[model samples]
Target: MAAKLEGGAYLSSFVDAVLEKLSPILEDDDFVLEENDSALELLGRLERSLYDVGSVLDDAELKQFSDKKVKKWLVDLQDALYKADDLLDELSTKAATATQRDPDQLQHKSLRELYVEACDSLKLLPLGDFPNLKKLMISKCQSMECVVVPQALPSLQYLSISECPSLVSLPALTLTVPQLEELHICDCPEINCFAEEFLPPSLKTLEVTKCQKLASWITSKGLQSEGLTHLWLGPCFDVKSFPREGCLPASLQALKLSNFPNLETLDCKGLHHLTSLKSLAITDCEKLENITEEHLLPSIEHIYIGEDCPLRWKLARRDGRPMV
Candidate 1:
């Protein structure tokens, strides 16, 4: 019976699978007969109930570990979902054997964008179904652990995920979504690395904030995309130095580092190859002091140092230096 839905992720996955099964059954107009109207109505009501209950499953999953009541409630919910799934499966089998419709007609081709917010119970996103989707934004999904993009999304351009605390890694974007251009990630602390070795080739802008483990991951990975132009990283309290020699790609045009409280040094060897970089901004780094003269590359036209940094006054009054 539904493989005994165990963890929050598994339960959420099971619920999504049931919902997907119900979609085509409910969508087929021919399936709803005059005699079966009552059954169709019951299925419709069941769909609504599932949606209502699914919203809180993420929070409940977390609480279930500590509270026996939450665990029991989840067990009851899993049982109800299994029964609903069984009923849907029986009807689906009858419909498939009775009539055969063209599979191409069932595809959702025109859907271009999708946004999911605060779906605490959603653990996985079956993005392979939406081939034409261009932009996807997911925010505040506390229980979301993975985003499943099984096939290539040729049309996807921009993806932004924020406040997803449980997210462990992203789908291999460089291989899965080759057309992706912009990626913004914020407040997702658990993510340690990208699923793949490299970022998308089409990516131009990358911004990450308040993600300490991910920040360290990015630094260690060397931020090596050839097309990336603008980069912003901030509020990483553990970082003592940044852009460890050859960490940033030479294609970067503008870079901003902010709110790094423990940052003490800026590696000149790391900035040596950035011939295309024009604007550099460093702010809110209170302990920063060691920025040698060679750290300012010849290609840099504008530099901004916030007052909170100890080197602000030193750089401002330094002769022959362009300061802001």
Candidate 2:
């Protein structure tokens, strides 16, 4: 496929502009924003993720690189950013319109139907008995100390939590939100470990970041989910080693690990059990010392390692091709 001609800097600029407009509204105290509104909370997370992408693109300058993978990633990011920009525009209009509405009518506005943001704590009943709710997102609520899943959200298919520094634990997924298909938790520094029954068989995608305590847990007991296809764990400094094969599910197709600064060794013999694995990525693991063909699975088609990785040059392909 031909690469797009647009520059990455342009996309970075667009994201910066979007953040500029959205940040003020998020901080506006005059809007009488409800602390527990789920929809607005989801939007706040979307904004925060966009902001994070903007920061990454600004520093990456992907337009200068001729690599096909980098170009493709940039193109995909541009497409997503355009959609996010439009959504933010609509949200801004709603916030403005809601501000103009009379108090009585506003109380009954449908905008109140979404998830909440910036709550001091996630009590058990944020969305009490939300039987029909399909998605719930919580983000940037720094004071949120715990998450207690509501019992009636059997229909929930997606759940995400980000930037809640004080959040320490999450309820077991098997006990709550059994239908959840995607789960993402990011930048929650205080979370130490997931509940033992954390991986509900219905989940397909899982992503976790910047949770040192959780990273440590993974080292001793890797996640196993027969239904999961994608897994990402990164930026957790406490993870000193990788999990053995018995701890991982055979259904995982793509696995990515990043910035585990203390990681020193990986048991490749243990990784051979992931028969369905297609892609493996190890980036910014500075202490990782060696990676040989024995440590890789024949099923892996794409392997990406950062230049800073100690064993980048040692990683090879089963088919005699370069392993990047």
Candidate 3:
């Protein structure tokens, strides 16, 4: 007997239902359990964690809209759970087919089959099927080049892509995702440009790392959002300076820049326009010798610069000096 609660269905019970349906098949003599012991152990751990997660989801559902942070946390949690479920399904299918056979022949067959399956899974990402998708993350897909967004995604709030070295660009993906709120791109070196209109007005946070050729955000009328609250750019060596034209978002509240060896200076005029900025961090820019704060706003409260930075004295505010 199951309790009839008046809210979202519990995920733990869903997993239990799956296990109940699959129990008889797993007990069959054709399904050798010993051959799939490792996968089953992992599946057990995932199931237990998901059971704990269901409580968190239930709690969040009751108070999500009242708190912005809670809503964001729920989105992230749901995205992670969705990915875990996909991987669990794949592992379950693999386990169901595991069987004992001659040692030498079984070893060779398993290796070839696993390699083919891994390759196929890495190349296919069917995001277009979800009409109300929010928060998508595609990681470790080495052979992926293009991610196609076929339809409008008004509900999408976050997107993250990482470790896809062969990916050249996001083609026609951002056009349909106008409501995206956060984006993170990491370890994708071959990417060159984030074209105009790539970032929408609804975006609040953007983080990029180790993208070698991505010179600057304002290169060609791109990344000119006024609603951005946080921006992080790191390990992008080719970008020698912040855009000289003062194109950064005026509504930005936090900014972080790191590991740009070629970066020489940041245009003070642009930095001055960030009236809402509360935190600014710059690190590991070896060649950054000339930084000006002539027009910097007084709203900035926290400032962090590397030891090599020449503008450290300008950031200090303990001696009754104004942060002008």
Best by TM-score: 1
Which lDDT tens digits does candidate 3 get at residues 265-311?
Answer: 77776787787888988888877766554545578787777877655
Candidate number achieving the greatest lDDT relative to the actual structure = 1
After superposing candidate 1 on the true structure, give the runs of residues whose Cα lies further than 4 Å from its correct spot: 1-40, 43-107, 320-322
Worst 10 residues of 1 by lDDT: 93-102
**How many clashes (backbone atoms < 3 Å, residues ≥3 apart in a chain or on different chains) does model 3 have?**
0
Better of 2 and 3 by lDDT: 2
Q: Count the clashes in each prediction.
A: 1, 8, 0
Candidate 2 lDDT over 233-298, as tens digits, reads 887777655756577788889989988888877767557777899998889988887543355677
Q: Give TM-scores for every candidate, taking all chains together and pairing residue i with residue i.
A: 0.70, 0.62, 0.59
Q: Per-residue lDDT for 40 in model 3?
A: 55
- lDDT of the candidates, in the order given: 0.78, 0.69, 0.62
Across 47-85, the per-residue lDDT of candidate 1 in tens digits comes to 887788789988987787689898888888888876777
TM-score, candidate 2, is 0.62
Q: What are the runs in model 2 whose C-alpha is more than 4 Å off? A: 1-113, 120-125, 292-295, 316-320
